[model samples]
Target: MIGVYISILILLAIIVYLYFTKRLSYLLKSKRKLLFKSLNKVEKWFLAGSLIATFTFSTLTNLVSSVIYELVSPNSNKEFLKIDEKQDTSIELISESNEKLDKLLKDASIDPRDIEQYLKNLPLKDGKEETNARIDEWYQARKISLEIKELLLVVTKVIFEQNEDLTNTITFLKSTGKTDFAGVLENIQKYFQEGDAEKIKQEYFSRKEKVEKENILILKQSIKSTEALFAFQQTVDLYKELILVEPTAENYFQTAYFLHKLKYFDEAANLYQKTLKIYRDLAQENPRAYLPNVAETLNNLADLHSDKNEFPQAQEKYEEALKIRRDLAEENPIAYLPDVATTLNNLAYLQNVKNEFSQAQEKCEEALEIRKKLAKENPKTYQSDVAMTLNNLAILHSEKNEFPQAQEKYEEALKIYRNLVQENPRTFLPDLAMTLSNLAILQNAKNEFPQAQEKYEEALKIYRNLAQENPRTYQPDVAMTLNNLAVLHWSKNEFPQAQEKYEEALKIQRDLAQENSRAYEIDYARMLIMGVKLFKKDKSNLKIAKGILERYQEVYSAQELLKLIRKLE
Candidate 1:
């Protein structure tokens, strides 16, 4: 193309030069008629030769350039030429389309946390117009991607149903056109026309199973990347589809596990029960093979029941798991004693919650003995367990008002936690904070005011920092510590200090209640009542406290607050 343009320009320049120099006019003069006529003929021949040479050179150069482009450029096709012509107007559109498609794929492949970050960092405008535009673009892109995926899925399904060779079909489609995914449907129609019945059925099932296996693998990847609730749900649905194809124990167990993580307790419990039944049958036939699985499922079921506060059911399942674990431990204590100890600890905690004090104490003692022995041999792993048991025992003692005994246990737990925290602050700081809080409560009960105040302050500092780091998880702990501090001040007859702490705690609880009333509203109401009692003689405080109580009158704690108000009146 460039060569042709250059040749045309050169020929024009030559003709202009001849005209400007009067050479053509001199040839056509009448002063020497014969000579002028001969010159005119010669001039005409020269002009003709120049035109032929220019035309021939331009054509030959352009042909050679076209041949080189075809040989060197990988995308040199008729479509490439068409696209090149439209590149200027369509470049941005093509780029945006590709970007949206990439985003859709990324959204499918990433976890919920990543999705949250993506959404959080998305650019925003001052008005709804830009936001609306972005949303519309996202929706359109998502819709298109989904439609394309669905089409592919349908094509795959049809090919499997017809018992055709998918590899062959894919190759054929590519041969037709590399980007011609739509051609898959046309290929499917051709396969249907060439189909045989019995052979096709056999091939269909074989190919279907292969494709199903591949899909299952992909679904597992999706599950690993799925952290958002909606993504988890979608993954669960995919698991269900896989189960429909092959209702294997692994499939059912995986689906139930995801449900449990999602906190779908009822559904998870049902699936776990089904899993247990399967494992029980398998274990009965081959105890050595599947008995361990039975025990594992029983433990999981117990934990699930415990989370739902179905303590009786939880205890029953725990005991069954404990029995199996005990038998297993007797055969190989080195391998299974840890499981035994963990189950005993779990059972002990549930017993304590149920106020079966003697039974809880016995279980805790057994767990503590096992953990102590394990820690003696392997403190790196079992020392934390020992500390945990000591803490639980301390809580039981505190509840029973055995102040000295509770104090002894709390001191032991706190010592271990302090050492652990020194080694790994991120892991053990919360434990240290909790133990300090418990010790402070025990100290207050013993009327050791100065000691209790110091402990409370220490715990309060830790809780404040933790809440600052992750308010969603630790804010409630901060509120609890503030309330404890307020009680300590009240015990010491420091009314102003007590009131200040109570107000701070109440504000936090109120903020929390806005998000989850069932969890925090009772605390808010109780704090209001404490405020009322602290300032019963002040008209302003009483009025404010009464207003807060009246506002939350529907709360369970409101009745107690109302009684305090009535006595004050």
Candidate 2:
């Protein structure tokens, strides 16, 4: 009996120790800055290393920075992801002069084939004359989004103009009959005119997301009547309004979401921050209610930062989002597991960027497993997700130099997308093209030049066909594929072939950049830079390459020109 009592006492003591130690470890992890280096590394320098002085300094710097970062952030170590955002300025779309708008209005309606095919698809009862007029009006509204989006900026400036001479601007707005943009402007004008701006903000802006979802849905419905022109401004103004509304996290998040879609990174970043700040507080108060939003906002903010190349911020946000989603998934796997997979896939991509291939592989595998399970449950909803994760995994494997695994993953993803395309050609066709292009890249990396060429040609063909139907959406893909093909040709020492591809790709990119610089300039510049690399060693060839970029000195902004020159050097 005494021996049994003694065993019970020891077991109780062990349990008590574990409970306290667990609590203590949590506190330490959150509060303390752990040393980054291994004792083995320190001991090697101490005992057997030759460059003690140099290695020691580097070691101390790492350690110091770790502690300093801990102090600076008061947050845990955040993983960094690559920024995917391009050089989109505050003003994304641009129109140099008011003349562009006048010319746009004067331009002929779109092709008769386009109008006829579109009308054939829709149920229309109007006579040919009325139908043609409607098409012309709709055509102009469509052109505003593509040909000269910056006209809206000018329109806004005109709307805000206090000066009495608003005749031409008014006439221009009135001319946009299909969009009813003038009437939309009048509503804004009347609202501003009627209300005290501060009072309007106090009442409207203070209203949180819960009360505004219905309004947001109504705004979406408004998208049909106003099209892209009015929808972009009105939706952005609704939940996303700045000076007129108070900072509502949902509102700001929604606003930032639209802005990000519009490639307004600078504006999006500020609004995302406002959303995050509020969401963080709300999450702290009610994790169950608001934590998902916190994770969502973090995910988007991380993506925004990633686009901007702010890797550190991206890492921190992705990790936090991953953690939150994991927790949420544990509580409700059906709802949150997909989110967990998405965050994991994101982290995997970032890890690949950081050259942590093993870590990336693990995350990709985990994401693949989760997505596969989800796809099994709801194949229609999650099949694409599975393919996406497989694609990401394939990239990770390629980065790790596991060629066979990469090839297998890529093929699996390609097969899935091919099958999907059979059911929904329009939606899945792009995915098919994307996977082909990626596989072609992998083939290039492996020096299977023939296979690479075949894949590139296939992707190029798809993109070319898609671009014919939707140039605004798919032309960039055409340029990208052409550039990649150029690189492949250059690798094969086919200088003439490479040069032809490069020039063709550059021409397409130039036209696209002119149409929408915010969307395409970085791509154009990057392709030019890549093309220049081909002639880096040959002085004569290099001069010609430099000439290609230099010819456009007048076209690019001073800042852009300088940056390109520096990059070239």
Candidate 3:
């Protein structure tokens, strides 16, 4: 009844507005003005009273309707504003988390006082028991919550060495779905004081203004007791920072070398390039002493750039490096053959990327021929290098979309890697898993979905097992496989399941990307863009998709595919 009344009042109000605007009033006046013009004063007065009463009634009804509107739908704009505010808050939280992670990495040696302080400031639950109970409930409600939280908790506990109940914690986690907790253990081993002592001693000895022999001897004694890898990493990082201030060719080379080991590609590339420049200047002044280092540095820089997909830049650097190596090999035929072969392989890789399959094939064959000769004469000594070269050839074949050749090469490589991994499960399983995953990628590309899934699952099992043993190294890999599986599902039009897996992958990437250098940022951004596109298909999310696409290009450009993307309607 109230709604009907309000609707009628609103309609009448609209009519009144039209009349006042002269729309309705003009129509009525045109037809009725002459009829009213001859009216007597008393009659006109009566007519004016009726008109006034009707106007008063309509005005009162409009006022009542507005009051009802306010009561029923009060402050809708404020409610919408609140929702927008929360979304902004979430974005802010994500940004803050990233910053915190960077700070943690930068001040790795600073004893995490800030993280501790933040934890203390965070509102505590009633008690640890109560919190545990709630967590258990969440675990029951969402199986993943318990697994993820426990993995994080255990990893943190191991890193901090805070709790004595680590055995129980590990046991509990081990009982859960095949989650990788090994990363925590590895971090523990890396950070434990005694484990790092040797590294510290070595760094101490390597100081340019060398420590006194007596000091070195004392440091060697101290090394027997120090175990923390994190401390060594901190020391190494400090040394790197100091080296940057007055970077010599040697210092730059050392920094680049270590950064490469740490997989910090951008930093490593910059350092390597700087080292190359310095060495080149030195070589121009005195070619004999610095040429070898200059050539090696160029090659290293080329390799780094190649890995980062700066193929054109990489090709130029590789050619320069190859010229140096080839010139040196001509002079020192016996000693430089291996280096020449390595350069050939590197060149072949670039050629493969450029789709010059025949040229790449010739280069690989040349490298393999040299390696085979070396291996035949000294099988035990050159076995591993020979195996690796074969693997490289296989990869080149894969690049050319020649599955049979690639598969054959992989099989050959697998035979070697399998044996090696079997002899050392802890060291080799991860590599085996990686190989399996690469093979899986090939399978997926061929639309052999079931086979690809099998390979991925197998790789996942290995990675998960390794992650269980050492998560820092392997959990992210498992997450990647999970994502791959999800993509497969998505390709099959299994949207809901794909979404679930994507969310899972996102959770893992969120954590891992925090620790990774900018080299991995593109991968993270791609995943984000892919997720947004998938979600937006049934909705309109042009803005979010565009933002992700923009970020992806920021980290990576020069790909031709981006032009096609721009052409998208």
Runs of candidate 3 with Cα error greater than 4 angstroms are: 1-294, 297-317, 327-334, 349-361, 375-388, 487-507, 510-543, 556-569
Q: Please list all clashing residue pairs in model 2, or write none if there are none.
A: 79-315, 83-306, 83-309, 84-306, 84-307, 85-307, 205-246
Best by TM-score: 1
Each candidate: RMSD: 25.2, 24.6, 34.4
lDDT of 2 by residue, 138-250 (tens): 54666423322333333333323321122232354465331233343344333333322232233333433433432222232222112112224443554444423345575
In the range 1-569, model 1's lDDT, one tens digit per residue, is 88778788878875585667565455456444543454567676776678788888888999999899877975425533433333222322322332343433332332332332333322321223443454456546663233233222332233233223334434543654643332433333333333312222223333344444333333332232222112344455655655676565655666666677567899889878988999999988998778777887889899999999899999999999999999988888888899999999999999998999879888988998999999999998998899999999988888877788889988998999999998987568778999999999899989999999999999999988866544655788889999999989998999889888887888898899888775666666666666666645344555556666677777656767777768876
lDDT of 3 by residue, 1-569 (tens): 45455556655764575466455654467756654565569756765665566666667777798888788976535533443343334323323343344433332222322333222322222334543454455456653233344432332433333222323433443554212432332233332322343444444445435323223222322221121122335434544644544466865775576566456898888778788888989999999788989888888888888888899988888888888888888898567778888888998878987888888888888888878777787765565667677777877788778998887777676677688776666545666777777777877888888888888888888877766644655667878988897887787788897788788877787677677634344455556556655655322233433444465564334133244344332
* Clash counts for the predictions, in order: 0, 7, 20
Write down the lDDT of every candidate, Cα atoms only.
Answer: 0.67, 0.63, 0.60
**Clash-forming residue pairs, model 1:** none
lDDT of 1 at 255: 65
Instruction: Let me know the TM-score candidate 2 reaches against the reference structure.
Output: 0.54
Superposition error at 536 for model 3 (Å): 8.6
Give lDDT for model 3.
Answer: 0.60
